[model samples]
Structures are given as structure tokens and as C-alpha cells.
Target: MSQKGGKFTKEYEGKKTGRFTRNNEDRKNTRFTRSNEDRRSERFTKNNEDRKSERFTKNNEDRKSERFIKGHEGNEVNETRPVREDIVEGRNAVIETLKSDRTIEQIFVAKGNMEGSINKILGMAKDKGIVIKEVDRKKLDFLSETGAHQGVVAMITPFKYSSVEDILGLASEREEAPFIIILDELEDPHNLGSIIRTAELCGVHGVIIPKRRNVGVTSTVYKSSAGAVEHMKIAKVTNINIIIDKLKEQGVWVYGADIDGEEYCYNTNFGGPCALVIGSEGKGMSKLTKEKCDKLVKIPMVGKINSLNASVAGGIMMYEVLKSRIDKKMQ
Candidate 1:
């Protein structure tokens, strides 16, 4: 097009006519996008390295921890497994244990059941400064696996087992001598509780059992002992036979309770320091256990059962031992 003052004219409008027209803004946008992409790429690389470092740290820590635990397996470190439900129920059977063991956490009493004879138990608790809580029936039901709690349950740490060597040291310190019960897998906690109670009553030193096969203290055992397990010195060993051998070394006469043995408990001399071995209910003493006993004697059965509950058998034997000691003292 021709204008009045122009010989030739090319009409160029705004700075936007295709790629070069928007070049400045587009370059700005491109630079912005490139900056953002660069930031994102840097962020991704940083995150990847962080994750890798975290995994490496965790793996090495796990391996080191495994090695530390593995190295300590043979060493004597205090270890515990969860106490069995029956054992929890029976904790009350050993009342003295409630006082002696620092690990007794708490006692649960049924809402209205903490009265009367149970009141004395509360009194003991009060004296010992134990914490008591009144829980709902539902809570108690959930806690006590053995339905026989009869309104009382104790939360106890695993029974603190002292060593046979520790008891031997106790025996060695005392001029009066040691009186111990060497149980050959007495399976019932009730019997154990009662015997422990009796041992405490009769002034026996401590009771021993094999680590495996024997009944650990249970809620029932604790209940049956009427709190006796708490007071009696008890040792749990890896091997019952090893304990027997140790007892014999320490001058403790080994006596096994059996029907076919030569002498009756009444006739046998309990004049010296002694270890009484009682067997399980169905299988009395294992053959190996029986073979280790210096003497195998039976408690005479007047009743037709021909066998006694381990606790009863043990109680009888404990009293006999006590009586023998008394008789010897009199002489």
C-alpha cells in the first residue's frame, strides 16, 4: 500500500509475528521451566541418596546388633520369657514371694471379692507396700487364663531363680546346715506351692527343679501355696542330675521318693543335711533321675491310690525330714 509521504511501505505491526515475535517471553518461560526442572532433578537425586544411606545404616546396625546378641548367648545375662498364665494365677500361692521379689508389679482383686480372708491378704499387701487395683470383671477375665483365680490375680515377673551355687554358699555360711528339695520334674504347681510353703514352714533351705520338664510356678501353684512360693528359696537349674551331683558334692544326702525303694521315709535317717527328690505324677522319677539318687525310699500309702499328689508326697516327706532333724537334735 502507498501512503502520501512514503514511496514504499511494508506494514510491520506489533513485536509478535510467529516465533521471533514472542521470543523474549518464550525465552523467559523456557528459562523458568528449565530452572524448575533442574531443581526437581537435584531434589530427586538427593532423595535417592538419602534413601540409600538410610538403608545402608539400618542394615549395618542390624548386623552389628545380631553379632552383639550372638556373642552374649554363652554369657550369664538375666533373661526372661513371659510368665505362663497358670504361673501368673499361682503367684499368690507364694505370699512371701510377694514381699521378697522386687518384680511383683501389681495385684488385681475382683470388685467385691477383696474382703474377709482376702482382707488379710490385702493387709499383707498394704504392709509390703504393693499396689492394688480394682479392675472390671472383663479385664480380670482377659488377664487370668486359668478360670480358677477365684477373684484374685497377681502380676508377677518371672520367678527369680537363684543358682544352686548360691544356695550352696548359703548352706556353707550357716552352721545349722542345708535342707533342700530336689524335684525330679514335679509337674504340678499346686504341689510345688504347698511344698514350698511347707519347706518355708519347716525351715528348708530352697527347692530345685530341672529347667525343662518341671512345672514353673503358675497362678494355680501360687494360689495353692497360699503364698508359700514367695518365701521359699527356689533354684531352677538346666539339669536336675547336675544339681543332684552338686548336692552330693556339698554333702547333701540324696533321697528319692519311690514305692519300690528299700527303706520307708519313716525308717530312713534324715539325721544329716539332705536333698529330697520327688518325681512327676504319671512318671515318678525318670530312670536317669532315679539312678542318681543315693537312696530311693517310699512314703507308705495307706489309701488305695498307691500314689500321692506330688505336693502331698512332698509335704509328708518334708515333715518327716523335719521330724528326723528334731529327733536328732533331741539326741
Candidate 2:
């Protein structure tokens, strides 16, 4: 009986050991499977990160390329755009420019709108060997700065400025006393233009304006001058007071137009070599400039309004000077 019990115990012990070994093996296999899944998840995460990195790099490159293209296009547009001051519009202005010595780059006429004076412009342009182009009215409208193009626009060289010596030389060549107009910071382009037209008609030698605080020879001035700008010599000076002193030394009587003047404009003697100084529209003249004048003269006023438009007063004063010269010539 004792030997049979021993065999039973050894068999039971061996079976228990085998079952425990199998359970240990199952745990190992489960751990290995979980490790393998962890490795796969890590690889998937790395691949996703790489894809995200690639997308981010591509997006950056696309943005850079887009900016480059837009910048290139903007440069092209800027290069093709015309300068505003280089353009001259309107029929009379263009025709007068054509008749002048100014260099016309090209003349653009509105298509199917060439009729009365346009034919004359074509003839004049042909005579001068200028290039004429027919374009849509929209093109002219776009190029017109004065909004009164009248179907004709001329692209000309920038208005050339003359020196003070050149202006005096022109008077010498004409064998006339130096009849000059010196503006004191005139702001209005229309007023400047009208004054220039009147100056041309009155046989004035040249017009002088300061480099600062004055309207330049713009398209509006050109249109207002009725092409008279072409025939006029305009000088831009650094110091108008210095120029006034120099003119006084040269025996040129410097007259200032002011509301409060000792003498009327018609009574003033403008017969000699003279420079008529027209003040600004708002302020009559700078204190320093007024002090520099040889004489301050006023236009006669009987109307309720004591003040006159700068251009109107300037015109009246200019006519008075011209009348003085004519009267002197007759005497």
C-alpha cells in the first residue's frame, strides 16, 4: 500500500509542474504579441510624422513661389505704367505742343473721334515726324489727368526748365526790355496757367518761380496756358529774394502787387526793364519779399469786394504794364 501511494504522488506532482510550465509559456507569448503591436504603433506614428513634415515643407515652398510670382508681376506692372506729368491731353494743348519745339514721344488720338482740329494736329505731327497712334477712348480717358482730353493726348518729354540767364538772354535776343513775371509761391495751377497765358500775350520775356512752394508746369497749367507754355521760358530759382536783389541791381524795377499799396497799378511806371511780382492767392506776399520790392502797387477797386482773384488781379496788373510799355513806345 505504501509503494502505490508514492507512485500516485509523483505522478500528480509531474502533472502540476507541466501545467505550470504551460501557463508560463502562454504569458511569454502574450507579452511578445503586445511588444509586436507596440512596435507597429511606433512605426505608424513615425510615418505619420514624416508625412506631416513633408506636407509642411511643401506648403512653405508653395508660399515662397506664390510671393515670388506676385512680386514679379507687380514689378512688371510698375514698369509699364506711364508717368502722370509726362502726358499732355486736350485738342488745343496737343496742337499747341505740336507747333512748339517740345519733343513729343508719341501722340495718342481716340479712335473714330478725329475730326475738326484733330486733322490739323495730324498734319502738324506729320510735319514734325512724330508718331501717331489711334487707340480706344477708354485709353485716353485713363491717361487724361485734366479730365478734358478732347480725344487727343500727347506723351512728351518732361517740361524743360530754363535758367535766369537764359530768360534774360531771350529778352536780349528780342531786343526788348526784360519784361519778367516773378511769382511768390503761387499754389493754384489754374492761376499759374492763366498768368502764363497772359504773360505770353503781353510779350513777357519769361516767368520765374521758386523751386519750393510754387505750382510747377503741370498738365493743368499746360491746358490753362492754351499751349502758351510751349513758347514761354520758365525759371525755377532757389531764392526768390536773392533773385529780386540781383534784378534790382541790374536796373530792373521790381514791382509788387498788393491790396495796400501807395500807388495804383496803372500809375506805376513799368516802361523800363521790369519784373512784376504777383503774390500768392491767399497771402499777398511774404514780409521779406514785400520789403524787397522797389514799389508796391494796387489795382483800382470800386466794387463791394475789395479783394480780387489772384489771376484776375495779376492779369489786370500785367495788362497795365503792357499798356504802359505801349504808351511809352507811342510817346
Candidate 3:
């Protein structure tokens, strides 16, 4: 009975040891599964953070690019605005202004350009007590309207217009017949400037232009005139037709320059107190204005083009009148 009891006790002890080993193995498997799940959660969180960082970086780059483009456009706008019409640029223009009776506010010359005609300009400015400033080339470029400043720019007072009486009075003061150049809706500033220069040389008493439809004397005109605008007397009237009739009553012969004129300009009589009418660049004289003239005179042209430039045609007519007057004087 003692030997049987010992065997049973040993078997029971072996069974208890096996149960303990099984419980420890189950615990190890559960711990390993939990560690794997924790590692996966950590990796998922790290990936989400990295994606968010990438998106934020891209958004910041887009915003910076947008600001840069807007700033570039704004700079272009500031560069092109505010064109100045009161400034006269170019060396010849400034020299003529100095010789004229027109008041100059100031003169700006580009630095390192004091040679040749520049010295002459400085001497004249000193004589007139005009302010002379030496500025950077870029400043002169900014102030220039004609883009041909030639390193000099003059800021002068606005042009003062003359009246019809002033023009007639000038002729009277010179003890000569009235030699006038009347512009009919002349649109080109360069044309007007060239006409003024020629008229001044031709000893024209004054130039008559309508207040409307005609270009006012601007900087371009001043530049184109090469400063002849200073010597020429320009009268802006409301109605050129009315002035024509009044001149006729005063015994001034009005002549229209046209392609279909009755007589050639050279044959026509311009010896008396005369006013020549020049039309616009494209269209010739208006019908009513043409009718008001005492006679229509044409320039001889054999070219394929039917019309001449307004300034060129006007110059020829003016020279004819000047020649006629000279011939009469010689006689």
C-alpha cells in the first residue's frame, strides 16, 4: 500500500509541472502580439505627421510664388504712368529756348556731358539767370517725352497764346503787309511745328488756328519746332471762318491751297496783304472754309500720289508769297 501511494504522488507532481509550463508559454504569446500592435500604431502616427508636414511645405511655397508675381506686376505699372507734357528735351530745343523771350523755369543737363554745344548753353543760362542743374542720365530719361533729350531738358513756363489783334498789330508795327498762315484743323503736331518754323523764316506776321480740332502747342510741338515756336505768334480763335470774313473786310486776301485750284500757286497774286490756308493731313480744307477764300491755288505735282504733306505744301506756298513780296520790293 505505501509503494502504490508513492507512485501516484509522483505522477500528480509531474502533471502540475506541465500545467505551469503551458501557462507561461500562453502569456509569452499574448505579450508578443501586444508589442506588434503597438509598433504598428507608432508607424501609422509617424506617417501621418510626415504627410501633414509635406502638405504644409507645398502650401507655403505656393503662397510665396503668388506674392512674387503680384510684386513684379506692380513695378511695371509704376514705370509707365504719368507722362509729362510740359518738358522740352533735346540740345537744339534748349538752345533755342535760351535765345527766345520765353521764361524758363529750370534746365536739367545730364552729368558728364559738358562739351561742345553744352558749354554754350551753360553760358547763356548764366546770362539769363536761369537755374541749371546737373542730374543723372536716368533722371533726364524719365523726364524726357520725345526720347531724344540729347542730355539736356528744359522746364519752361506754359506757352501763352496771342489774339487776332496782336497778330495784325505785329504786321502794322513792322510797316509791312499782313502775311498770315491759317491752319484748317491741322492735326499733326510735327506738321504744325514745321509750319511754324517756316512761317517764322518767311516773315509771316502770325499763324491762325481754331481753338478746337487743332492740336495745342505741346512738348512734341516744341521739340519739332526746334524752338521756332518762341518767335512765331500763334493765335487760337473760336471760328476761323469769322476771322476770314473780318480779314476780307480789312482787305486781306485769303487764298486756299487745294489740288483742284483754279490757278497754280506761283502764278497767283500773293503780293497784297495775304493769308494762306493749309488743310489737315488726310483731308484738305473744309468746304465752307474753302468757299470763304478769295482764290484757290494748287501746287504742281506729277507724282503717283495725289496729295502732299500739309507742312510740305504749306512751306511751298509760303515761299511763293515771300518771293512775290521780294519781287515787288525789287521792282
- Candidate 2 ranges beyond 4 A from true positions: 1-83
Q: List the residue pairs that clash in candidate 2.
A: none
Instruction: Give the per-residue Cα lDDT of candidate 1 at 292.
Output: 93
lDDT (10s digit) by residue, model 2, range 14-85? 888888788778888788888888899899999999999999999988987675444333434323444256
Q: Model-by-model lDDT, in order?
A: 0.74, 0.87, 0.87
Models, CA RMSD each: 12.5, 10.0, 11.0
> What is the C-alpha lDDT profile of model 3 across 87-175, one tens digit per residue?
77787878988998888999999999999999999999999999999998877766665567899999988888999899999999999
Query: What TM-score do all the candidates reach, one by one?
Result: 0.67, 0.74, 0.75
Query: Residue-wise lDDT of candidate 1 within 1-331, one digit each (tens)?
Result: 3573243222343323444657877998899999999999989989989999999999989987665444332222112223464335533452555556546677887798766656776887788777888877656655554456666677777667777777777767776678888888777666776787788898788888888988777665666767776666678789999878877997889999998888999998897989888888888999998999999999887877788888788889989998998998899
Residue range with the least summed lDDT across 10 consecutive positions in model 2: 70-79
Per-candidate clash tally: 19, 0, 0
| Candidate closest to the true structure, highest TM-score | 3
Residue pairs in candidate 3 whose N, alpha carbon or C atoms collide under 3 angstroms: none
Candidate 1 TM-score, true structure as reference: 0.67
